[model samples]
Target: MHIGLISILSLVAVVSAWLPSDTDLFGPEPQTNATFSNLSAGKGRVVKKWLPSSGKIRGVNLGSLFVVEPWMASTEWATMGCGSSKSEFDCVMKLGQDAANAAFKAHWARWITETDFDDMASYGLNTVRIPLGYWIDESLVYDSEHFPQGGLAYLDKVVGWAAARNIYVILDLHAAPGAQVAQQPFTGQYAPTTGFYQDYQYDRAYKFLQFITNRIHSNTAYRTVGMLEVLNEPVNGQSSLVNTYYPTAFSKIRETESGLGITDNAKKLHVQFMNKLWGSGDPKSGLKDLSNTAFDNHRYLKWDTSVKVSQAGYIAASCADQVASDGDKPLIVGEWSISPADAVEQSSAFEVKSGSNSGFYTKWWAAQVIAYEKQQGWVFWSWKAQLNGDYRWSYKDAVEKGIIPKDPGQAYNQGVC
Candidate 1:
């Protein structure tokens, strides 16, 4: 959709103000009113609430939802290849420009809007996490004239579509500058150390979070945008790295956006301290962490053919306990993907394959896990990704006839109160 002339002009003016230098999108003012509020004792568990008449998650089951990265939603998009070249910034800039344009087109927009969400809602999904790139917000970049209007307008449309169907949208900042996942898509590089802890990149990330929190909280339509994921799969190689930065960033965001109240005060502080303590690896730091915020963790079992899933249950339980010990705060399995084989083996200690037991195994295992941990909510690994040939990870297949049965798009509408 074409952006309104007024918005386009306004964005152009903003862009001109920061052409030569990347100005701070989040101004220097200290947001003071933002403070954490503690949850009452015994009320720390993930409670089931029904969706309000406005079609939002109020009280409901912590079920899986199909997630799609709309910023990467393009027919021509490919895995990270440009970063391997010498001039990484040039390559990234070129790719980013192309991606931005392609994402704006109606073709990509309609594909994600029509196919992904509609089909996911039909597949017993209560929520859909849409991972947007930090660059999408023109206000953050301050150099792109087309960004503020185009990106914001497109996202506005996305939120409107989901709200109409009562589908909860989790706004995930997947492609943070520091490469939250430490690899392609975010940094356009593969296992590179140079991009790991760049100060400027981290600064950019902090700014992006502020921009997103401000933008979403400002729009009433996005109240359905339940949570803001600080970072996606922040590598555990060194806990100190994130621990030192996360709290600082979290404080900045909370101060900037008062609407995103510190819902679970104790839990939030605890997680932040845990992140720092874990990063620092200093047990005797004598840091007492607070609690009351939702903690995000991603898990893929050993059998998933990527990371060993054996530790999946352990990681989940451990994180839960951490939150509980500090205070009672909700834990969200921000991302996970386990086939029938992995799920069955984990749940009932039975090995299964994807072919013969595809249907039974998938359904049984998914239900088993969801039932196993009724408190902590989860959003499945992905709805789609850059893949080749026939792949189980393809949401296209799940939407068609793979994981979903009957009308996949309407499956989420069932049992959604």
Candidate 2:
């Protein structure tokens, strides 16, 4: 999700046509049959198990991909100078279809490349959480869909790249069929309402989910796609609906993917569910009763008005909250960032220097985050930022500048998964 004008992989070489450069990690060409031997155990539940307290995953999110956040590409949006656009759909439509298509093409090509993925692996991150809007698949987009058409192909390329490097992918449905959370452009709904809670939208979203499950589970190159979140951060009070959706989605996915030769019941792809913005561990939380499910909570410090502590105090508070909320449950901190309270309203130029709150604060914060997340696992809000100066939000810049430790041991505690 893009906030105002603010926010937002890979190694090449195993991919034959990915890049003009000759630095492929997998080999001269990508492996035809990829295997997760070291990471997979007893039907691949080992990988899913790696998500909880038993094993740990340190990772980063691939944000602003299928969904674009205006602030990430503020400069591009500034060219149009459209006033107060709501979502990417509005922004693109404002630009006119032809111009929007061309601009998106350039932005997509440059925003992320094979070299980026290579950098992530080198940074020691074991998992990459990729955010995707529901319309990525053409059938889901319907008549109003006007963006360039290779969305799924681009996703396949990224997943394939991750597989070659032995990194896992958490394919997150950031935007559901009808804007699960319509406030942001990330949800792909240009209108005022998310529309996802309605019966019509819910049915469309359910079918879309089924389509996604069948496609990925059937693809060999996507063996590294370890988890598929039903939706990212649905609005509050939809818990009962979300709860119903989860079991139905799980059953649909399970039935569709059952042909993959799975014998052990525990070893299957993880279907992650959020609490749907319900209070932490609420009795009505959708995730409470789902099987083969994982809990995902997005934790943020800067957004909490009550976060008046110093870096140390903030760490203690955050760690305590996470510990309490996720005691022995299979969970992941699906979204987090290194942003500090003191620098909350600053510009990217002013914010990037000294690593958000100076070197000592940033390093200490990163260490604490890694340590806290060891109970289960965590994914930073983003791997990179559109504004290079905004290193506080970008794992790539943080690691490169040494504000955050680049040691693989810190980023990857769960071995290969």
Candidate 3:
């Protein structure tokens, strides 16, 4: 579920000594008029809200250096030919570290902070999914037993920054040790794998989650770091990979970290599992084990050219049905993009594109999303990136065309929502 939705459902209102309004990192001036509404009255209560319907579920994936090393370019690393060779892989790793440090020194350390949080808050987005790479804690480096000090320090800053603004953060481990996205870091793609379902890979991933859960759950400051994405885009073409690996890994996470102050519901983890298992139909029986966990899924409806518009209803129904089977665990569409061809097809059965129809698909899909605010919430993929041409798809264009408000500071002020 969108972190905002979770926050709302678990809403708690607090009247603490008001701190100075957080600064804006990159956008216009802050909105002094913005006020916090206490959903509950209590001392030191944490305020949470169901995702807001102020506007479209406009959110972005803060990627690259924040999640992966900017210097670790897929093309550049591939050219280095570091496959399976210890010496070459070491060199690549060093380069990646150097790149991460340099990027942090250059802008990442400054641009991503309370100000950026303020920018996002003003932008009408109620949630931000921060993608994380396993290496940040030094766990992925060959032979390293301890997490990295510098990495944890940087993330701590991120948590404090987001919390001050009342913006919910989803700590997404985008690149696990096996490099959940093989072409990306952490997967040791420089070192190839047998495929996504490797046993050792699942073990390594579980350890990573355990480490992260332990660290985050222990810290009250990071209580706002809602939902841990087991993996990003796992069921793409590798449905078998997730089908084989997710259940086992998910079960281990619950057994290891159940009842931590992290969630209110006990069956949260089970709900997450059944939601992931819903579509295949192999598990015909509904999820017998339910919990407080929400089902996380990503949809790039436009990416699969073969999927027809007529299929949109079925897709939505199937997803909703899966979540409902698990006592209606919150369903969050962690990622999605808009495209015209798909829009045309789904319009008959679902909401059609509107306005100029130029970017009407995005608007239509967003409307459909907003319509479901009470049922579930979503976080769109991506915020800003220097590698616009390669990594960013529609996001880059959307930002430029005013689809995504560029002047982040003025977003909430526009009153469009």
Candidate 4:
């Protein structure tokens, strides 16, 4: 999800020494009698419902943790001397594998912890959308391919914590093998040459999917992980997604689960695809048959430069976003923000400053929440990031600033909408 800019979190106490390795993932599982109240999205549906009975998925993204964005580090990336670098690829290349791994490993360790999960639970938030790079599974990367390894241990620990807090997680493949998009660091690399469409890349991606899917279904620590977003923002090479990738991934994931002796549709993982092919054509254009799936659409009004609408018009826009939910599968707004359009930011009448006392942001937030709930749910772009006071992409800052209410369930702007 592109923002006015780019991610981090805070308030996590040191977790006890428990890291899940390949050996640890399946062994005497950590004694967590976690009641997965949130991860259980629903049961007895061919096309599942990812929303709760009472409300939508009031959630935030751990966007920058696994997929690093240099510009928006919660702590300044420049101070780390990697500021000039555009993405993790540049950082790993510049710092070399070992040095870059140390920096990133440390960042991943401290940026988020159980305390952050507790904080999210306190707000009654139901889900977390975790964006991760394809490189997390080391086997896929070759000698020449430079990507940090040993990330699965951290992922295992984080999802276990989420389970304890009764929060669900959507493990998203943010960056596929050849950098699905040119979005730096976020895509795990600064891939100027988009090669995800190549046959070799698809094979690697399928392997990655099998690896991750098996992990989530088989690992008790990952009980909180409910959805596997097959890909994130596939703006390039769109035809393959519907005609080939989506169908194949659906079969591969289902087959993997079935092989694990999981046959009931209820116990299976829900795969999420882009609500529509982004920079390509319609999602339904050549969509094949798939089951146990949902859709994800990201709406960032911040980039609209055409015409600035009034605050009331913003509510109208949120209320009017029915097209995002037009698909047969359930929809979730994977990313959105309270940030106004570029034109609105420049408007003298709106006074659109980040975390401004202008009730504009609050109303906009509520409007989208109410509207998004009408379909399935929504997850705000990010939980924490570098922008000091701007709540545009930072859900943490928004909640702290009172622009977004601590209890998201309260429809503060429901009357207006």
Strongest candidate by lDDT: 4
What TM-score fits each model?
0.59, 0.77, 0.61, 0.83
- Report lDDT per candidate: 0.42, 0.60, 0.46, 0.69
* Best candidate, TM-score: 4
The candidate 4 region of ten consecutive residues with least summed lDDT is 1-10
Model 4: runs farther than 4 Å from truth? 1-55, 277-288, 305-307, 343-357, 412-414
What is the alpha-carbon lDDT of model 3 when measured against the actual structure? 0.46
Off by over 4 Å in 1: 1-107, 142-149, 187-191, 194-199, 239-242, 259-292, 302-328, 339-355, 385-391, 405-417
Backbone clash tally (model 2): 12
- Candidate 4: tens digits of C-alpha lDDT, residues 1-417: 111100111112111111111112122232344221212322321222222233357789997888888766846566545667888777778888888777877877888888899888777687889998888878788677776656777888888798777577888989998887765568888878676876788888888888888777655666657688888887754677677777777778878877776765656777888876244444555546555677788877666443247677677787666636356356788888876765556566455463343576777788888878776677888888877566677888777777777788676534647
Error of 4 at 114 (Å): 1.2
Which regions of candidate 3 fall more than 4 Å away from where they truly are?
1-43, 46-58, 69-91, 94-100, 103-107, 144-149, 184-196, 235-248, 255-288, 307-328, 339-375, 387-400, 405-417
Please provide, for model 3 over 1-417, each residue's C-alpha lDDT reduced to its tens digit, 9 standing for 90 to 100: 001111232233222211111112112334445433333213355342222212223355665434433342343233334333232224435446455344344444654556666667766565667777555555545553221224566676677667666555666666656444444443334335434456776776677677666555554455455556666555344554445556655665666556443333311222233244334332213323434455655655554454454434434432343223444445666665444343454354333233343333333344435433434556655555433232223344455555554543333343222
| Best of the two (1, 4) by TM-score | 4
Q: Which lDDT value does model 3 have at 364? A: 38
* Sliding window of 10 residues with minimal summed lDDT for model 2: 13-22
